[model samples]
Target: MLRGFTPPYTPDGRSSLVPAPPWHYAGTVLSMACPTEPAAAARFLPQGFGRATGRIIAHVCEWQATTDGWELLDPVNAQYREFILLVEAERDGAAVNFCPMIWVDQDISLIRGWLQGWPKKLGQVWMTRSYGLDHPAAAPLRAGTRMGASLAVKDRRLAEAAVTLDGGEGQSLGFLAGPTYGLVGAPSIIGEPTAGALRLVLPGITGRVAGPMASGTAELRFFDAPRDELAALRPTGPAVAAIGNVAITVTGATDMGVVAG
Candidate 1:
């Protein structure tokens, strides 16, 4: 039987409610700066935070990992896709990514994300790569190699994009490092017969970019989902789209405070 601080195990013993184990990711990422409706975006911002300096950015990527915690060889946690809608926001005069929506297919990921206030949900995600047999292994981001991904819920597709990393400049991951804010609603400890309290969670993780694609063109399709926060991503002009491999570690989280009513 599972004991200690490990999350409860399933009756079938197939899965558990534990966070993802430390892992490495090798994949391609596409980022674009898009136009955002200030009013609509503000709805996702937490208290004491304001809009960021630049336009909102959208990130779509597909990743294959050694493992997400149960075990290194576990197939269930080895691969997944991610779609992130990030807006620039300021907290205490510090810039950060105000992640409004993030979708993944794994359950453990969902739990861990919620614990950190990532607003993560389960969704169908996919990415594809085009390569030839003679392609040089040393240069994974070869010219003419194309990649694309889509984020969908049920039968509805919310976002889709395809890009070819023909050429681009090198970029540092430092530009991407900043505070990430998430909002989570949990049962009130006071036990009052009222709506559960919402808390803003900030998780701390260490990661770095491994590869870089300086420039690329992306064909994107975004739909409106009135009930979903992803609808806030409105790309006005295409920003520099790049490709890269990243490694990240999920350390822990910090609870900021309960949202004032």
Candidate 2:
């Protein structure tokens, strides 16, 4: 049984042919999430992160209340605490295992090497036993419940999920990006109303995706040119709000769900 919480989702009937990736319900993943609007955060975002951050903060609140987990609390000055991003999915669908934090860059080739087949060292970043060859090594959006902690999240909300990018020529690209921000307070994974489509969502611009792609099944080809495949891609223009639906299914204590790419 899952010891934590469950994330919300709105169903979109647009289902895809691709199955969930192998890492979804397996090992650890190296995820990276950057703030898409660092400028806005500095100018308009809350003075602190954590619960004060808004909806996503609220979601964190709920997850902590219900789940049995630990957070890094400060004992000296009695300030500054850090915790992992907790998300829940269904016992079956996409509510089992969910790691909602991940942000990496192209220059950080070390992460890429770890994701492919697990290298000894890529660059400046070396892998620890916990991070090495771990299929689902998680790197959630570090949320700071304390005053000083939240101030550190200064960057783009760019994320690289655990999946490869390079493919041959058969797989098509079927994916979902966000509610614009992320899963709301209660973390609702919302999306379109059709078959072959599903999305999990958050406030401002965060969401989950499930669909097919001509690029190939994300499950089989996520390790090729992973740098290209895992880059955070959110759709804009006319279809930004209407068609981007998401659906999430949790497996267990491992992976949250698979994003169809």
lDDT comparing candidate 2 with the true structure: 0.20
Please give the distance, in angstroms, between residue 180's alpha carbon in candidate 1 and its true position after superposition: 1.6
Judge candidate 1 at residue 256 and give its lDDT. Answer: 78
| Least well predicted 10-residue stretch by lDDT in candidate 2 | 58-67
**Top candidate, metric lDDT:** 1
- Could you tell me how far off, in angstroms, the CA of residue 230 lies in candidate 2 after the best superposition? 16
* Per-residue lDDT of model 1, residues 1-261, tens digit only: 444224565445444555344544556666655556666666667666676555566677666555444345666666667777777776677767777788888776677667777788888887664333656443356666666778898677888877666655735322255677777777654766655888877776666556545556666667877566575566555554566666666566778788752
Measured on C-alpha atoms, candidate 1 has an lDDT of 0.65
lDDT (CA) for every model shown?
0.65, 0.20
lDDT of 2 by residue, 1-261 (tens): 212111122243223211122211111122212222223222222122122111111010001100111111321211111212222222222222222432222222222212221121211111111211324443211221100011112232221122222222222111122211121122234574333322233311122343222121111001123332212222111110011112332321222122231
Where does candidate 2 stray beyond 4 Å?
A: 1-84, 93-95, 103-148, 151-261
Off by over 4 Å in 1: 1-15, 19-27, 65-70, 130-145, 170-175, 188-195, 207-209
